[model samples]
Target: MDYSEAIAIADDVHWVGRYDPGRGLQCNAYLLHTQAGAVLIDPGSMGDFPVVFRKVLDLITPEDLRYVVVAHQDPDVVGSLPVIAEVAPEAEVVAHRETARLLEHIGLRIPIRAVPPEGGFLPLADRTLEFVATPFLHSPGAMATWDTATRSLFTGDLFGAVGAPWSLFAEGAFESQLTEWHEVYMASQQALVYSLDRLMQLDPERVCPQHGSVLVGDQVARANAHLRTLRCGIDRLVSA
Candidate 1:
């Protein structure tokens, strides 16, 4: 398989993100095949889109796209949106209202289906996608997408691991890397705790973050538990 290859991560979900060895960033994106249509989660940065989009085309064409789900307004997550919008003009942009506002602030005028603060649902032909509000874990309007059919959670930044050399699916404990990433990227320990608590309630079978390997089985629970005690912001700085 080439660099622009799609790897199956779940039933019908493919990991279409590209790995930047030079930058040690996974910059993950996902192609979900839903009954209604195909959904691209976190299309990734403009620089990474060419490879990501090529991999996506290996599974489905641009016309097959139905929605472009935005976890947050981060460029790494949705920066290549102009290209995506041009190719898949019919794909409705799904994101939190605040995210929509942020995108608009940047002059992105594509159609948006904003999720409420409490979060909302996206009805696919065969399944309903649950959007859960996870505010300030990293971004103010951060939201995670839960695929009930596959029991996978698409967390924007929560549970992400930095550096490279990780597989598409984690084989062992990634606690150390996970901790390192969160301690610096996560806004505050309080925000992390609240978001982690809410995310854990879902008990996801797969934990897919925007920047790291997919955590599966018991690893998901362990990461959540480990994250609960993590300190960020002033606490981490003071301790250091």
Candidate 2:
């Protein structure tokens, strides 16, 4: 795939993430073309900003960007957000209420829209994007975004992984890498289970995460099951 161009994930969505070498923590960003314009998700860090921004430019100009969604407040996900908001002043900042507080330190001004804790949907033109609050999976304000039209679930750190020789998509032994990452990075199995349960209800067609290969088709169910049973953080220690 051309690293400079946005790779199509679904009909109207594209993967604008950059894959860098030697970094155990890789990030993935996505772009969704809506009737209003482009919606950027997890714009990636300052290090990744150049590549991610170029990919977005490949599809549309900065003025077309409508919304910027940060799955969580992590620097890797929201570091590039300020630049995006600068370039596209019309774009609204969308995130869970808990995460919104941190954005203030970055000097981001109000009317920041908080996605409802239960779940909320953003209607742009004719298409709609939904947000599912996944508090404490990793952070209190952690959450995931869903594109209803494509059944694409943009998860934050909840389903992320780390490894070498990584393919863009989850491949052989991917579950082990994914499950292991969660056991170490996630706060607890209870938080993981709760979020997983809410996500499963969506029955997403594809799983787009912030820090790992994207999962599609059968891979989604398999990975979901693999992570659902693992004990994490304090739970892993207590069980041991």
User: Pick by lDDT: which candidate is best?
Assistant: 1
Per-residue CA lDDT of model 2 for 122-141, tens digit only, reads 99786898899887878888
Residue 152, candidate 1: Cα error in Å is 0.4
- Clashing residue pairs found in predicted model 1: 36-125
TM-score of 1: 0.95
Compose the digit string of candidate 1's lDDT tens values, residues 88-164. Answer: 87788999988888887655546888999998998898888999988886888999999989999999888888875
lDDT, candidate 1, equals 0.86
Each model's total of backbone clashes: 1, 0
lDDT, candidate 1, residue 59? 92
lDDT of each: 0.86, 0.85
Write out the backbone clash pairs for model 2: none
TM-score of every model versus the real structure:
0.95, 0.95
lDDT of 1 at 213: 83
